[model samples]
Target chain A: AQSVTQPDIHITVSEGASLELRCNYSYGATPYLFWYVQSPGQGLQLLLKYFSGDTLVQGIKGFEAEFKRSQSSFNLRKPSVHWSDAAEYFCARIDSGYSTLTFGKGTMLLVSP
Target chain B: DVKVTQSSRYLVKRTGEKVFLECVQDMDHENMFWYRQDPGLGLRLIYFSYDVKMKEKGDIPEGYSVSREKKERFSLILESASTNQTSMYLCASSGGQAYSNQPQHFGDGTRLSIL
Candidate 1:
């Protein structure tokens, strides 16, 4: 079975600082990867996705993620994170056979002024 | 934009009572899914339907049943509500192709409490 792992449980970063959230997946083959953000009391919104093309995929809200096949990892990065970027981040991979998504435990991001 | 609407934002029901949570999508998607979210645990799939009257069990299907009489609407039913079932329920929809790599659209979610 495919699984996603997010190592950090909570991360606090100062505003305007660079941000990177780690994600690792265990799968036999290259699977579609995605990043999603969820604000308090709201549903999750897609940040970005990696299908096949370039390893580096850009997403909404000035965010981007790079897929590294060798490490079996896809990490999300932002040059400068705003206060509004504080939320719970989740990394997911598409189930090869079922077309469903398997998500990570999630990392809570806190922006400090 | 794809719109997935869950009927209630919050619901309170008594233990052992029958509970129903409704979801509807406007994108005419062929795949609809139900998941539960809890602290320290990410979303866990409860059930999913690819077509009307076609339902598949997800990772956690115990004490839960689903109904998909219409293509756009999917309902999750709790046979007998329990406090352990108190959690946030989310609904999602995806494209028609079963194996296609389409992203799923999510709703605001319904917070259900069984007391």
Candidate 2:
């Protein structure tokens, strides 16, 4: 079974600092990776996705993720963190089949001023 | 923009009561999915429909059933609401097959509280 792992349970970064959210996947074949963000009391929103392309994938709100095959990781990054960027993040992976995705436990990002 | 709407933003029901959560999408997407969001569980898929009248079980379908009588509406039913079923329920839709991998658009979600 394909699985996604997000190592961090919680991360606190000061405003204006750079941010990186790590995601790892366990799969035998090609994998479709995605990052989603959820604000409190709201549904999950897609931040970015990596299907097949240049390893570096850009997403909304000044975020980008790089797919590294050697490391078995797809890490999300932002050059600078804003207070509004604080939210819970989830990493997901899907292999060609039923189209259902498996999600990680999620990492909570807390931005402080 | 894809428009996915849920029947309620928040619901409170007594335990053992039957609960129905409705979701509607205006995009006419062939694929509709229902997921439950818990504190640490992230989003667990409950059920999904690929086409009208077609349904499939997801990772966590034990307490739920689904209905897709119309192309735009998909409903999730809880045979008997339990306290453990109290969580945020999300609905998402995306095109099927040729557009299978498209990012799913989501609704605001319904927060259910089973007493």
Candidate 3:
């Protein structure tokens, strides 16, 4: 079964500081990775995705993730984060085709001034 | 922009009562899905519809049923609502190509409470 693990359950970061959220996925074949953000009382928005070709994938709102094949990790990173960046982040994976995706429990990001 | 709309933002129902949660998409997406969101559980798929009148049971579908009479609307039904079923229900839609892994666009979600 394809699964995703987000190590950090909660992370607190100061505003304008760099941010990185760790994600590990388990899949037999090539994996499609994705990052999504959810605001309180709102639906999820896609941050980025990794299919093939590029190891480094850029997403919306100044976010990027690198897909590491050997380590089975696709961590999201941002050089600088704003206070509005505080939200719950989820990492998901799916095998080839339009199948269902398995998501991590999510990491809550807290930004402080 | 794709817009997935759920009929209600919040709903309150009594135990053993029949409940219906409606979802509609404006993008004419061929794939519509229903998922329940809970703390620690993240999101669990309840049902999925690939096309009109075609439905598939997802990871968790024991307490729920679905209807997809039209291409743009998919409905989730609870035969007998239970307190355990109280959670945030989200609706999403995606383009249904065989090998395309398009991201699913989500709705605002419906928070259902069962008494």
For candidate 3, the docking band is medium
Ranking by DockQ: 1, 3, 2
Model 2 chain A poorest ten-residue lDDT run: A93-102
Candidate 3 pairs with clashing backbones: none
Please give the lDDT score at residue B36 for candidate 1.
98
For DockQ, candidate 1 versus 2, the one ahead is 1
Q: Give chain A TM for each model in order.
A: 0.97, 0.97, 0.97
Q: Which candidate is the best by lDDT?
A: 1
Q: What order do candidates take by TM-score, descending?
A: 1, 3, 2
**Model 2, CA-based lDDT:** 0.91
Where's the lowest-lDDT run of ten residues in candidate 3 chain B? B96-105
RMSD of candidates 1 onward, in order: 0.8, 1.3, 1.1
TM-score of the second chain in each model?
A: 0.98, 0.96, 0.97
| Native contacts conserved, per model | 0.60, 0.51, 0.62
**Model 1, residue B75: what's the lDDT?**
99
Over the stretch A1-113, how does candidate 1's per-residue lDDT look in tens digits? 77999999999999999999999999657598999999998888989999899999999999999999999999999999999999999999995566788999999999999
Residue-wise lDDT of candidate 3 within B39-62, one digit each (tens)? 989999999988899888899999
**What DockQ results do all the predictions give, each relative to the true complex?**
0.72, 0.57, 0.68
What is the Cα-based lDDT of residue A32 in candidate 3?
83
